[model samples]
Structures are given as C-alpha cells and as structure tokens.
Target: MKNKLEIKIILSLCFVTIITAVTAVPLQSAHAFSWPCIDRSDGKAPIAVSDDNVYVAWWGNTTGNYEVMFKASNDGGKTFGDKISLSNSTNGTSVEADVAAFGNNVYITYADNKTGDADAYIRTSNDNGKTFGPEFKLTNNSDSSLTSSSLPQGMKSYDNVKTSPYELKVAAEGDNVYVIATGGDKNDTTYQPDVFIRVSNDSGKTFGKDINLSESKGIVSERTEIGVLGDKVFVTWWDKGSDGTDTPLLRISDDRGQTFGDIIDLSANATDSNTTNTTSS
Candidate 1:
C-alpha cells in the first residue's frame, strides 16, 4: 500500500509541474519593441530604415585608432546581430556614416581619414550584413599633391586634396543607387562646400557624373542628409550665410537630382538663429 501511495504521489507531482509550466510560460506582448543587440559605447548616428530591417553605423576610437562599426536589427530594433568593423585601417576616424537598405542588400557610406585627408568611402553587403565587398574610395584623393601644406591655403584642392567633411547619403531605387556628398576643392576659397550626386546603375560597379546642388556663393553649406521617396530626392543642410547667421534649408529634386526646386526654409521663424533641423519623407 505504501509503494502504491508513493507512485500516486510521484504522478501527482509531475502533473502539477507540467500544469505550472504551461501557465507560467510568457506570451508575446504587444508592448514588446526592438532593442539594441550590440554595445553602443561609442556615439551612434541616425539610423536608416527599409522594408525589411533597420541599419545603424557608428565610429569609435579603439586603442588609439578609429574604427567603423555596424549593427542591424531584423525585428524592428528588437534584436541585432553581432557588430562588424568595416574599415581595415587603424588611424583615421570614421565619423559621418550612413546606411541604406533595399531588398536584401545594405549600402553604407562614410568619411574616412585612412587616406589622410578625410575622403569618402563606400561598402555594400549583398546577403544582408553577413558580408561586404572590398572597400572602395569614392573620391580619388590618392594623388599626394592635394594637401593644404602642398598648395596655398586658398588654392583649390581638387587635384591636391579632397576635404569631404559631411556624410555621404545613399538611396537605392530599382536597380540603381544614388549617392550624394558635400565637398569643395581647396582652391575655391570663395566656394563653400557644395552638394554632389552620383548614380550607379550596375549594382555599385561604376558611378556616373557628379552633379552640384548648391549655388550660394561664399555661403558655407555642410552636414547634408538625403532621402528619397519614389522619384523625389530631398537634401537638407545647415547653411552659414555671409551675414554670420545659420539657416536650416531643404532642396527637393523630382528628376532624380538632375534639377532642384527652390530652397525651402524649414526654420523660417529662426532665420538667423542656430537651430538643428532634420527632415524625412
């Protein structure tokens, strides 16, 4: 009778345990949201969102050298994959990096001092962010002559130096990719930084002519950000006028950046005030 009673007790315990487990299991909550899966000890820039996922890239100083890092969240920022370092160089900083995703591919652009003058570089990953192609310097500043020390401070640096301080913006539509950057040749002292756009139809294999965006003479335009919706390409920047005042500006292009409409003043109230601005379409 004792043995029989022991067997009954064991069965009861097992049944209770199973019932508790079934009741304790947590269900997916509607409040659940995506979180960072990677360590963001370094500063992170604005992230780009596509249909499938979101991409975020950042720069950090590691062991006295600057490195570019990337992370992607598949479930709307709920979880991210392992972080990856894109740049192989050890000295230059990766400051203004931007990411864009289309279909299963992700494209990144940033300013790197690996070449010493803060030139622009690009990398693309086909199978999500699993792998990236070889790093390509978008601006050919490899020639040694383009340096402030080599030429007069006021001289143009197109042949000698390439100073592209702003982040490179990229948008992919259909099979073509469009990139925009702001830079100036060293010699045009009167020429503030100008926005330039390039297009690649062959899956980033080659790029086309550079198109200038800004026409304001002697006004310093910098920190450009770009976005695309359908055929419209919009760019926003902080422009420092000759009057020593800063303004937030936006320019839209309906013809794939071939031509731009009038500059829209986003901060009309704060015309001469220093205000940070951002826009998305």
Candidate 2:
C-alpha cells in the first residue's frame, strides 16, 4: 500500500511540473512595420546624414516630368518631412541627383537637359532642408560634335572639355565644395573620357574652372572619386592606358584644389592595377 501511494505522489509531481513549464513560456513578439518615405515610382535616391539630420535626394516623375526631389528627417529617419522639388525644370528633365551635407549646409547636384544639351546643376540650402537657394548651372558644354581623327600616342587633345553623359559626384567640407566628373575631349575623335574636377572655395557660392586630373588622351579614365580634409584634397580614378590595361591612380592637393601634385600610381604593374581604388577623409 505504501509503494502504491508513493507511485501516485510521484505522478502528481510530474503533472504539476508540466503545467508550470507551459505557463512559463512568454508570448510571441510583435513584428516591426516598414514605413514608406516616398510614395512615388521611378525614384533614384541618394541619401546623406549629418549628426541627427538625415537628408535624401532623388529624381522622380511625380510632377508630370522627372525632377529632383528632397526630404529631411531630423530624428534619425524615424520621421521625414514633406517632399520638396529641388529641380522644378519646366523645359528639361533633371536626373541622377547627388547630395552632401555638413552641419546646417545641404547641397543637391544633378544633370539637366534644359538647354537642348545636358549640363550639371546644383542647389544649396543653408537652414537644413527647410529652404533652398536658386538653381546654379555648373557645366557649359557649348560644342559636343563628334569629329574624326586619330592620335599616334603620347599626345593629348587639349580642346573641348565637355561634362555630360557621364556621372558626376559632389563633396563638401566646411567652406569648400568639390564636384568630380568624367569629361570628354571634342578634339579626340576616339571620344576617350577623362576625369575632371571643379572646386568652390566659398561654399558653392562660386566655382573655378574644370581641372583635368587624368590629362591622358586616347586612354579612358573613369570612376572618379574625390575627398577633402581641411586644406587637403584627394582625387582618384581608374585609368585604362594604351597598354589596354586598367590602373588606379591618385592625386593630392595641399592648397584645397588649387593645384595637385604629381600622379601617384597606386599599382606599378599591369597585373596589380585591375582593381578599384577609393579615397575618404
């Protein structure tokens, strides 16, 4: 009788343990929902952040035609303000918008074909993204006609530095701003692209002439990048020379884009040059 009683007691303890375990499990976690910042299609967005402020620049066709659009979030993208059209072009289509931000200053640059030919343009904002200044044209490509000719080699055509049909990037630091692009020479019949740069020391108020960083003709230079650190500027690009081989090159400027030093070949041999090089300050 005692053995049978002990067996019943043990079974009772097992039942109680099973009931406690089932009750100890927590409930399922709630799933997080994704919020749509913009409800438009055909948008090519580029975003930049400065401290708690997040800025986004894109090109969308919500206004009948493609135009540059912008929006800001001061609380780390948790909430975004109303979308604003930065490039409200009436006669042209603005595309491929790029953005850069430093403190209270924000910049948006893109390409437009308002003048029958595509050109680079920029718009700046001082009070974050609340208001923006007037549209500023950055490129003036007057002649882009294709000509036929041939260069024997070791010669570079110094005519017609056209900035269109290629990607352009913008970088800003304090009172200085930079725009790096790939430009083609009108004189070179091969239409080889070269890396060019434009600098603005007064924080986008004014810009200097386009400086050729590649300085090589009949050879293609592309995928240009720029970085600024105080008074120092660094530019890098992938260059394919007459050997038909890709090489990574870099140029440094100590006077804030005023002048660049000699070309510093990142790779000495052709085998070592088939890679992308990036620079950051």
Model 2 misplacement above 4 A: 1-44, 143-165, 187-189, 269-281
| Clash list (residue pairs), candidate 2 | none
Weakest 10 consecutive residues of candidate 1 by summed lDDT: 13-22
Tens-digit per-residue lDDT, 12-68, candidate 1: 111100000011222110000011112223346657676768788877777576577
Query: Quick one: best TM-score, which candidate?
Result: 2
Which runs in model 1 stand beyond 4 Å of their true positions? 1-42, 142-164, 185-187, 262-281
Please write out the lDDT profile of model 2 over residues 23-102, one tens digit for every residue: 12221110001111122243468888888999998887765777888999989999999999888887776776789888
Q: Clashes in each model (backbone N, CA, C under 3 Å)?
A: 14, 0
